[model samples]
Target: MELVDLTTTPAEALPLTAFKAHLRLGSGFADDSLQDDLLAGYLRATLAAIEARTGKVLFERVLQWRLSRWAEAGHQPLPVAPVTAITSVALRNAEGGVSEVAVALYGLERDTHRPRLFAKGATLPAITHDGEAVVSMTAGFGPSWDDIPADLQQAVLLLAAHYYEHRSETNGAVRAMPFGVVSLLESYRNIRVLGARS
Candidate 1:
C-alpha cells in the first residue's frame, strides 16, 4: 500500500505570527521576516512529526492512496482519518490498463478516526488479475491553522517552539518527536482494532 499527499497546506496559512510570539521573537528586528521562514520550517516539520505519530492530518489536503487489493469486498478502510471527500477511484487491471471507477458506485464513509470507502450496492469491483487500485480523497480537519482543533493547534505551537529552541542540540533533519509532543498527541492517536472485518 502507498499513500501520497497530492496537496499540502499553503505556507501562508500557517500561524507564522503566532509561532513568532511563542518563540518570544520581537517583530522590530529587520530580519524578522526571514525568521518567519525559519519558524515556518520548524512548524512544518513539527506538524509532519505530529501527524506521523498520531496518524492524523491536522490540516485539510488532498491525498492519493494506492492499494494492491481491498481489505474487504464492500468496505475498504482508508489509511488516513477525517476524510472529507473521495475525489476519484481508479483500477489498474493485469493487462496494464487503467479505468476510473464510477463515482456513483461507491461513497466515502467520513469518520473522525476510521474513515472508509463503502460500496453503494452489492460490492466493490474485484480485480481479476495482478493490478492496482487507487483512491484519491481530501482529508483533514480544516484548511487553515484556525481550523485545527485547539489541542492540536496548541501541540503544534509547543512542538515548534521546542524545535526552535533545541535546534542547536538536536539534528533538525531527524524527526525525533519529544515525550511532551507524544503526550500532546496521544489523545488524538487512532487505535486500530484487530478482528475480522465484518
Candidate 2:
C-alpha cells in the first residue's frame, strides 16, 4: 500500500465513536447463534447460497464503502454508472499460482448487488494461503494486496474503473486490469481533515 495525502478527506471518514457503540449494541443480537465449526460450515453454506441466488460473490458488495470515499474526493462518485464495487482482487503468485481475495468494503445491502468484478456470482472458490483474491484469468491481485496501504485503496478503485471501461462481455469471465493499475493506486487525495479534528 502506498501513502496518499491525508489532507483532502472529511473530518471523519469512519465514525469510530458510533461504530464502537453500534458494535456494543449489537454484540448479543446473535448469541450462541453459531458454533465454531458450525459457523465455518455456515460461512461456506452462506456463500454457496448467495452465489446460487445472485450469480456473484458476497464480497463484491462488501468493498463499496472503501472505494466510495476515494471516488468522492476525485471526480468519480464511488458508484459510477452502474458499477457496484471492487469485489475482491484476483492474484497470481510469482510461481504462476492463482487465488481470489474478497475486498471488504463498508456495509452491504440486501436484494441488490454492487457492480464489481465478481458481480456475476461465483463460489467462494479457492483462496490462496495469503488470502489474496482469485480471478479466472491471470490477473495479479496479489500485488495489490501485498502492498495495500490505505493509499493503494484508490488503486483498487481506479483499477476496477479501468476494468469496467474496457470490459468485454463476449467472455464469461472477468479480465485482468491494465498495468496502469499502479497509477490508479496513486490517485488518493491528501487529507488535512484528520489533523484539523485533532
Candidate 3:
C-alpha cells in the first residue's frame, strides 16, 4: 500500500477510549436511558461506504445495527459505519528500520468537503520524519473500497460503525471535524483508513 501523510497530527495523540464508541452500544457509560442511540444508528445505515472506500468489511454483523428510520423498513441486515479509525501499519524490519503505511478517507452529504469519519477502533501513533519539523504524521491507502479478508474486515468495519454513532451524538452540540480512522493493515505492514466523515 502507498502511504501518504495527508496532514501530520501532534505526537501527543489522545487515547482510543477518549474517542467515542458507537452510541448504540450504550455509551459504555449507562445502560440506556441517559444516552440516545440516534447518533450511532445514523452511521450504521451507511455501511456500504466502507466497501466503496477501502473495498473491505469495516464492520461485523447487524447486532450493532443502528435503530434508524431506514432500519425500521427491514432489509437484510447491514454493517455499521465508522466514527474513528486508524491509518497506519507498522513493518518490523524493513529498509534498515521500521516502515509504516498511512491511509486517508472521507465522505460527503453532497459536494461539500466533509470526510465522514468511520473506523470506530484505531490507535493513532505519533509520527515524525527526519525533516525540519517534528510533526506527527499518518499514512495509508486512498479513497478506497478495496479488498481485505472477511473476519478482519468485519472487525474494522464494526469498530468504524460504532465510533461513528457515538461521535455523531456527542459532537452534535458543536460542529466537529469528521472522525478519523487509523489502522495497521497487511498484518501490520500497511496502513489503512476508515474514519468519521472528513
Candidate 4:
C-alpha cells in the first residue's frame, strides 16, 4: 500500500503570526523576519509529527492512496482520518491500462478516526490481474489554522515551541513529547482493539 499527498498546505494557511506570538519574539525590529523561515520549518515538522502520531491531518489537502487489494469486500478503511470527500477511484493494470471507477459506485463514510470508502452495492469494482486500486481523497479538519480544534492548535504550538527550544541541543539522549502535548492529542488518536480490522 502507498499513500501520497496530492496537494500541499499553502503558506498563508500556516499560523506563522500566532506562532511568533507564542514564542514572545520581539516585534518592530529590523531583523524581525530573519527567523521566520526557521520558525516555519519547526512548525511544519511539528505538524507532521503530531499528525503521524494521531493518524490525523492538521490541514486540508488532497491525498491519493494505492493498494493491491481491498481490506474488505464492501468497505475499505482509509489510512488517514477526518476525510471530507472521495475525489476519485481508478484501477491500473500491470500493463499500464487505467480504468476509472464510477463515482456512483462508492461513497465516503466520514469518520473522525477511521473513515472508509464503502460500496453502494455489494462490493467495489475489482482490480485486474497484477493491478492496483487508486483512491483519491480530501482529508483534514479544514484549510485555515483557525479551523483546527482549539486543543489541536494548542498542541501544535506547544510542540513547535519545544522543537524551537531544543534546536541547538547537542545531547545524544532521546527525548519524548511533553505530557501536555500528548494529553491534547489523546482524543484524536485511533484506538484499535485486538483482532479489529482497522
Candidate 5:
C-alpha cells in the first residue's frame, strides 16, 4: 500500500510568529521580516520531520492512499492519525477506469492514534485490477497549527530552533533530536510493527 499526500497545510497556517517568539527575536528587529521567512522554512521542514517521525499529521491535509487489497478482509488501518473523514474510495479497472465505492459500504473507526477503514458489511469490495484501490481522506488534529496539542506545538518550535541553530553545521555526528525534543515527542511517535498486524 502507498500513501500520498493530496494537499499540505498552507504556509500561513504554520506557527511562524510563535516560533519567532520562542526564538526570542524582537518584533521590531531590522531582520524581523527576513527572520519570518527563515522561520517559515524551518517550521515547514521541522513539521514534515515531526509528522514523518510520529505518523500524525499536526494540521489538516488531504491524503490519497493506494492499496492492493484490504487488510483482514474487513478493515484497513490508515497510515496517519486523527482522521477527520474519508472523502471517497475508488477502484480502478485494468483498463484504467475508476469506480467509486459507495459511502454506505464502509466507514471510519475513529481514533487519534490509529484510525481504520471499517467495512460496514461482511466483506470489502474486490478490486479487479492490482494496485488500483485508492482511499482518499483528510487527517490531522485540527484545521490549523493552533489546534495542535501544546506538547506537539512545543516540539515543533524546539526542533525548528535546533534546525535554525545548526543551519551552518557540517558535522557528521549530528543527533536525530535533542533530549528534550525526544522526550516531548516520545509519546506521539508511532510504533510500527515488524510484521503484519495480528
Candidate 6:
C-alpha cells in the first residue's frame, strides 16, 4: 500500500502570525522577518508530526492511496481522516492499462476517524490480476488555520514553539511530544482494534 500527498498546504493558510505571537518574538524590527522562513519550516514539521501521530490531516489537501487489494469487498477503510470526499477510483493493470471506476458504484462514508469507501451494491469493482487500485481523496479539517479545532491549533503552536526553542540543540536524544500537545491530540487519534487500524 502506498499513500501520496497530492497537494501542499498554501503558505497563506498557515498560522505564521499566530505562531510568532505565541513565541513572543519581537516585532517592528528591521530583521523581524529574518526568522520567518525558519519558523515556517518548524510549523510545517510540527503539523506533519502531529498529523502522523494522530492519523489526521491538519490542512485541507488532496491525497492518493494505492493498494494491491481491498481490505474488504463491501467497504474499504481509508488510511487517514477526516476524509471530506472521495474524488476518484481507478484500477491500473501491471501492463499500465487504467480503467476508471464509475462514481455511481461507490460512495464516501464520511467519519472523523475511520472513513470508508463503500460500494453502493455488493462490492467494489475488481482489479485485474497483478493490478492495483488507486483511490483519490480530499482530507482535512479545512483549508484555513482557523478552521482547525481550537485544541489542535493550540497544539500546533505549542509544538512549533518548542521546536523553535530547541532548534540549536544537537544532543541527538529523541524528543517526545510535550504532555500538553499529546493530551490535545488524544481524541483525534484513530483507535486501533484487535491490532488493526480502524
lDDT for each residue of candidate 5 in 65-167, tens digit (9 for 90 to 100):
9888777779888888889999999998778888999999999998767889988998778878454789999899888887999999999999999999888
Candidate 5 global CA lDDT score = 0.86
Residue-level lDDT of model 4, residues 50-165, one tens digit each, is 99999999899999999999988899999998999999999999999999999999999988889999999999998777899999999999999988999999999999999898
Stretches of candidate 3 exceeding 4 Å from the true structure: 1-36, 59-198
* Best-first order by lDDT: 4, 6, 5, 1, 2, 3
Candidate 1 whole-model C-alpha lDDT, 0 to 1: 0.85
**Residue-level error in angstroms, candidate 2, position 195:** 54
- Compared with the true structure, what per-residue lDDT tens digits does model 6 show for residues 1-198? 999999999988889889999999899999988988898899999999999999999899999999999888889999999999999999999999999999999999988889999999999998778999999999999999988999999999999998888878888432678899999999999877797654
> Every model's Cα RMSD, please?
2.2, 21.5, 20.1, 1.3, 2.0, 1.6
Clashes of 6: 0
| CA error at residue 184 for candidate 4, angstroms | 0.7
TM-score of 2: 0.19
The positional error of residue 70 in candidate 3, measured at the CA in angstroms, is: 34
What TM-score, computed on C-alpha atoms, does each candidate reach? 0.91, 0.19, 0.21, 0.96, 0.92, 0.95
Q: Where does model 4 exceed 4 Å of error?
A: 172-175, 195-197
Local accuracy of candidate 2 as per-residue lDDT tens digits, 70-96 = 222112222211223233345555466
**Global lDDT of model 2:** 0.32
Clashing pairs in 4: none
lDDT of 3 by residue, 1-198 (tens): 121234422222211222234223434455543333443333333333433444333322111111212111111112212212332234333223554434332111111112222222242232234211111221122223232344334444454555554553764532322333224233422233697322
User: Could you tell me how far off, in angstroms, the CA of residue 144 lies in candidate 3 after the best superposition?
Assistant: 23
The residue pairs in collision within model 1 are none
Order candidates by TM-score, high to low. 4, 6, 5, 1, 3, 2
